[model samples]
Target: MDKAIIDFFQNFTTSNHFILNNIFIFFTKIGNLGMIWILISLLFLIFKSTRKIGIVSLLSLFFSFIISNLFLKHLIARPRPFTTYDLKILIPLPKDFSFPSGHASASFASAFGIFLSSNKKSLKWVVITLASLIAFSRIYLSVHYFIDVISGVGIGIFCGYLSIKIYEKIMKNK
Candidate 1:
């Protein structure tokens, strides 16, 4: 099923130069290192009101990095889809293992941290939407399986929730 879904997107990417060229590929590339989300988190930190969530966002990113990149990816050691299948990797090939997509994990972890720590509903939606697209881009670019991104999303949201809980508890005690 995961291969089937990746094949569908790979076909779509090869099928239309316009959409792939103008949009999806760009997103997949942009999400490299979670740079896009990191930029957003930085902007959030610039504002006084959003500063708390911004801190949470960065914390979540940190936790996601250690958990997904440091531990889970090494432990799972899932092969990249492109390695297993004959597909053009749309971006610079990722060197790390693929079980839990670091892109998906970091993006969602930071975004959900922002969402859970802040009261701004509109910003939450924007962050979540971008995170969702980034997660999709992993599978779209042949760097990950659907299940990898799913596991990432699961890890990300959990980390985000845990960050907020810990932050709130520390603050409450202080």
Candidate 2:
């Protein structure tokens, strides 16, 4: 199933539409190192009204990085789909393991953190939409397996919710 999904995406890579490929590549680039999400969190942090959500989002990103990138990736040691299969990669090859996509995890962690912490429905939807696109871009780019991204999404959401609970606990203690 994973190979089939990847092969299906390969069709897009071979398509004549450079614009569509560029859009997916753009999503992946923004997600790299979680730079865009980090910037968003910092913007949230700058605002007095959104400070708490910003803090939660940062914590979520941190925890997701630790769990997905540092720990689980090493533990699982799953190779990238491109490594296992002869797939065309649109981006530079990642050196790390591929069980959980760091991009997907970080994207969701930040987005879900905002969703849980903020009251603005529009903000939540916007962030979640971006997160979804980022996660999907991983699979579309063939850098990650479908299951790897799915796992990353689950882990990222869990990390996000966990960060919120931890924040609440700390506040209560204070």
Candidate 3:
């Protein structure tokens, strides 16, 4: 089952490259800028009663990326897909490890964090959709394997949930 999924993603990575490439380029560019936007949004969250949740969410995401890249990547040492395949890469190859996509992890962590902090059902779906797009973008660019993106999603969701739980615990204590 796992191999089938990996094979499917690998095939899709190649077959969908054209479309994914374009979307990846756009999102990558936006992602560069969106980091700043997320910071600002986080700042806005500070003024509300939900400040603790926002901080925990943001910190959880930041730490998750740091630990993933700084520790896990080096420990696992997984290579990028292009390293093995004669794949035509659409974007410039990243210098970092590719086991778990930092972009996907960070984006989804923040989006899910916000979604959980706020009870807005509509906004949660929007954030989730955006997170999925970001994850797909990484695979589309040929920089990360299917497993990498899947790991990212898992990491992001875990950290996001942990952040929310911490916030809830803190709220109860206060």
Candidate 4:
């Protein structure tokens, strides 16, 4: 099923279509190590109104990293789809276990964390859209399986919710 899904995406991509490949590669690059999400969190930190959300988003990203990247990746020890199969990925191959995509987890963690803490619908949608793109790029790039991206999204949302609750509790006690 995983291979089938990947092969399906392959139909949309061709070696001649460097433009499309570059676009997906750009999305995947921003998601690398959650750098873009961290930058967003830091930008939020610069404002007093968003400081709490910023902190919470950072915590959410941290939780996602620890759970998906550190623990589950090692525990499952699943190889990247590119390693397991002969898929032609758009970006440089990643050297790590691939069950539960770290990119998807971190992107959704920060996006959903901000969504939970902020009241603006537009901001929420924007972040969610970006996160979704990042998650899909992982599969589009053939770095992760469909199940891995889906599970990563679930873990990310859970971590984001957990961070929000933790922040609320801390603020209430203070």
Q: 2 or 3: which has the higher lDDT?
A: 2
Ranking by TM-score: 2, 4, 1, 3
- List the candidate 1 regions with Cα displacement exceeding 4 Å: none
TM-score, every prediction: 0.94, 0.98, 0.80, 0.96
Q: State how far residue 42 of model 3 sits from its true place (Å).
A: 2.5
Give the per-residue lDDT digits (tens) of candidate 2, residues 83-159.
Answer: 88888888899899998999999999999999999999999999999999999999998999999999999999998
Rank all candidate structures by their lDDT, best first, as comma-separated numbers: 2, 4, 1, 3
Cα displacement (angstroms), candidate 4, residue 126, comes to 0.5
Model 4: lDDT to the true structure: 0.91
What TM-score does candidate 1 get on C-alpha atoms?
0.94
lDDT score for residue 93 of model 2: 91
Per-residue alpha-carbon lDDT of candidate 1 for residues 1-174, written as tens digits (9 for 90 to 100): 998998888876677666664576777777788888788889889999877887888889989999999999899798888888898765778887888988889989998998898787898898899889888878877789999999999889988998898889888999
Which scores higher on lDDT, 2 or 4? 2
Indicate which candidate wins on TM-score.
2
Write one digit per residue (lDDT tens) for candidate 4, span 1-174: 999998877766645577777888889999999999999999999999999889999999999999998899999999887776777766778999988999999999999999999998999999999999999998887888999999999999999999999999999999
Which portions of model 4 miss their true places by more than 4 Å? none
Worst 10 residues of 4 by lDDT: 8-17
